[model samples]
Target: MNIQNVTVIGAGSMGHQIAMLSALAGFDTNIHDVNEEVLKQARHKLNKIMDKWVGKDKISMEERDRAFEKLYFTTDLEEAARHADLVIEAVIEKLDVKQDVFEKLDKAAPDHAGLATNSSTIVSSLIADVTSRPDKVCNMHFFFPPLVMDCVEVVKGEHTSEETARLAMDVCKRMNRTAVLLQKEISGFIANRILFAIQKEAMALYEDGYADFKDIDKITRKALSHPIGPFELMDLSGIDVGYYVMLQQYAETGDPKDKPSKTLVDKVEAGELGKKTGKGFYDYHSRI
Candidate 1:
């Protein structure tokens, strides 16, 4: 399917950047959020990011201006989805919230518009049944901070049609990102599943007093050659996000082992959600 217009349902960390990428790809992009303040902030953040990109010579001023011209922010979901040929939902990672959005998107979007979720763990199969066009619902999981990440995971749900998956892959290509197509749906998909295993082990080691979280992170970085330690990565991605993902995983499998760790629970309860909030596994107040 030919996609010209794109809509991103949410104005949070992931949604705003995804909308920017769509606009940069020459698509008429609309970013919608229930909170008008969030829409305003997203617009401001996008401008700052684009300015930085221009300064770094990643994009020319003319190209950035053109992208801004095509990008729009709205508080109305119906208005955002109306002209969209594709809608990527990047809302909070709660199944019920996503299903609610997908149901509404089903009614608001055009008949041919493909609906995708940018969920890292929640599979599209669990969300597709809520929409009338289950075959058009697929997972287009973009990594955190879409601007720097070049890879997208395109997952085909049980009811998702081949055409819908192809459309998502094509859209990713247009946005100058690599797409990895998964023939079958799976919880946590590829990268996250591997990352989760490492995180789980790290958490266990920390919780068991085998080593301090900082030391574990240092070992991983120095010995394993990882770009960052698991704890640092969790902080970068938001501790609350990992907490919710763990909750979702436990809910799905009824396995106690999948439950969120005590450290994660405490961090979330304390409202220290990493770089965005200036605290998580590490303090970011000084840098901020």
Candidate 2:
């Protein structure tokens, strides 16, 4: 399948970068969001990012300009999906919200277009049955800060066709990303499952007063040689994102142990959603 036109639904942290990558790959890319303010913010943030890339000699000025030329921002979902050969949904992690977006995409996107989700934890199988084209639906899970992250998990849903998986992998290659194709559906997939275990242990230690969060982070960075500690990474990725992922896992398994930690719940309730919100596990307000 030749994917010429790409559409990204959502203009938040992950969506905007994914759209930029598609545009950088020479695809006609459209980014859609319900909020015009978010569309404005995405455009501003993307410009800064591309400018940084040019300054670092990662991409030429001409390349940045050409990529922006192919990129578009919109508030209309139908308009965004109408000409798309592939549509990647990067909306909130909630299952009902994703299902609603896929149902709308099924109605608006072309008959041959492939629908993918950039969800971190929610598997596409839970979402595919809502759309008529279950065979074309798969998980194209891109990590946070996609421009910097090189890997994409192209997961095949229970009903997803092999062709759809191949098309997703091809799209990843076009974006200069390494794609890891998973044959079966699994919640949280590979990287996150492993990361969550580390995070869970970190949180448990912190909550039990066995170690301070900062000390725990320091130990991981110094002792374990991790570039960033679990707390720092959570702050970078948004505390609410991990909180929601935990909630989803709890919902699926009815496991009380899977619930979000008190620290996460408290941070989310306080609207400290990480770097985006100026405060999460750490305060970014001082830096700003």
Candidate 3:
């Protein structure tokens, strides 16, 4: 199916960037958030990002203007998604919350519209049963910093149709992302499952007093030839996000090890979320 009218639910970092990508690809994109303040901030952030891209010669002024012309923001979910050909949900990672969104989207969105979740860990199967249109539901997981991250995982849930999967891959191609198709559902999908294994080991090393977090980050980056270390990536992804995903996994599998690390839980409880909150494993308050 040709997805020309795109709607993104949520206006957080991932949501706005995905919406921007849709607009840049010449799709009519609508970004929706429950809070008007968040929508306003997302609009400002998109403009600033476009300006920076233009300044760096990454995109032309005409490209920026054309994207803006096709992009819009709204506080109403139904209003944003009613006519949309695809609704990408980029909200928080809680399963219940995602299910609520899918339920609402299934009711509000056009019948032919495909519903996709940008969740990193949770699978669409957990959310799809809430709606009657399970055949049209799938997971289109985007990595951190969606603008720069070129890989997007198009995951197929139990009821997701081949057409839905193909349409998702097509949408990824339109957004300049390399689509990685997963024929089966897994909790964290491909990239995140591998990254989470690294995270578990890194946390274990820190707890064992093998190395400080900074040293661990430095050594992993230097020795492993990685762009960023596990701790740093965790901080970038939000400690709370990791904590909740871990908890969700633990709940699903009853694995004691899947329970969030004490350090992560403590940091999240203390409200040291990540770059968004100005603090995490590393402090961005001073750096930025």
Candidate 4:
């Protein structure tokens, strides 16, 4: 399958990064958002990053210029989807919001256009049921900083066609990334499931006074050789987002083990929303 045009819904972090990454890989890319200010900000941020990459000789000046030329950002979903061979939804982490997009895509997109979601938690199987053409839907979960991260999850849902899986894997490869194909649907997929399990346990330990948060972080980094500790990573990723994610998973499965740690929920409730908010498990107001 020779895919060319890509339409990314949602101009948030992942959506913006996907647009940048796609443009860098020479696809005819379009990013759609409801808010014009967000679309403008995403474009500006991507350009700034690309400029830095060019300055560092990471990408050729010609390629950087071409990347800018390849992108098309707009507020029109139908206009974006009508021309796309692939449509990737990276909107808010809400079922109704996602279903609404799928409903639009089902009507607006070309028959050959395939759908993918950059969802970190929602299982592909559950979301695939949103569309009449479930065979066309699959997961293309990209990691943070998609322009830098070269790994993606090409996840297959229950009704996902093998051809759809191949198409996603092929696109990832073309974009100069490694794609790990999940042969079956699994909640949280691989990385988040394994990583969050440890994180949840570490939070439990800290909450129970088994260790101080900082010490837990230090020991994990020192002993297990992880690049960063759980709380530290959560702070960087945003405590509120982390707490909400775990809670969402718990709400879905009703498993206490996967529930949000009280230590985390409380901090988020108090508006200590990690790095983005300047205070989480660590103080980010003064010295970093």
lDDT per residue (tens digit) for residues 41-156 in model 1: 99999999999999999999999999999998899999999999999999999999999999999999999999999999999989999888999999999998899999999999
Checking candidate 1 for backbone clashes, the offending pairs are none
Which residue runs of candidate 2 sit more than 4 Å off their true CA positions? none
Every candidate's CA RMSD = 0.7, 0.7, 0.9, 1.6
- Across 249-268, the per-residue lDDT of candidate 4 in tens digits comes to 88888988877777887897
Worst 10 residues of 4 by lDDT: 239-248
Arranged by lDDT, best first:
1, 2, 3, 4
Name the candidate that leads on lDDT.
1
* Per-model tally of clashing residue pairs: 0, 0, 0, 0
Clashing pairs in 3: none
lDDT score, candidate 2, position 189: 98
- Candidate 2: minimum summed lDDT over ten consecutive residues — where? 279-288
Model 1 off-target regions past 4 Å? none
Q: Per-prediction TM-score, please?
A: 0.99, 0.99, 0.98, 0.94
**Decoy 2 TM-score against native:** 0.99
Tell me the lDDT of model 3 at 253: 98
What would the per-residue lDDT of candidate 2 be over residues 1-288, giving only the tens digit for each residue?
878999999999999999999999999999999999999999999999999999999999999999999999999999999999999999999888999999999999999999999999999999999888999999999998999999999999779999999999999999999999999989999999999999999999999999999999999999999999999999999888999999999999899989998888998889999888898778898987
Cα lDDT tens digits, model 3, 1-288, are 878899999999799999999999999999999999999999999899999999999999999999999998998898999899999999988998999889999999999999999999899888889998999999999987898899999999879999999999999999999999999999999998899999999999999999999999999999999999998888888888899999899999998999999999899889998888999988898997
TM-score of 4: 0.94
Local error of candidate 4 at residue 263 (angstroms): 2.7
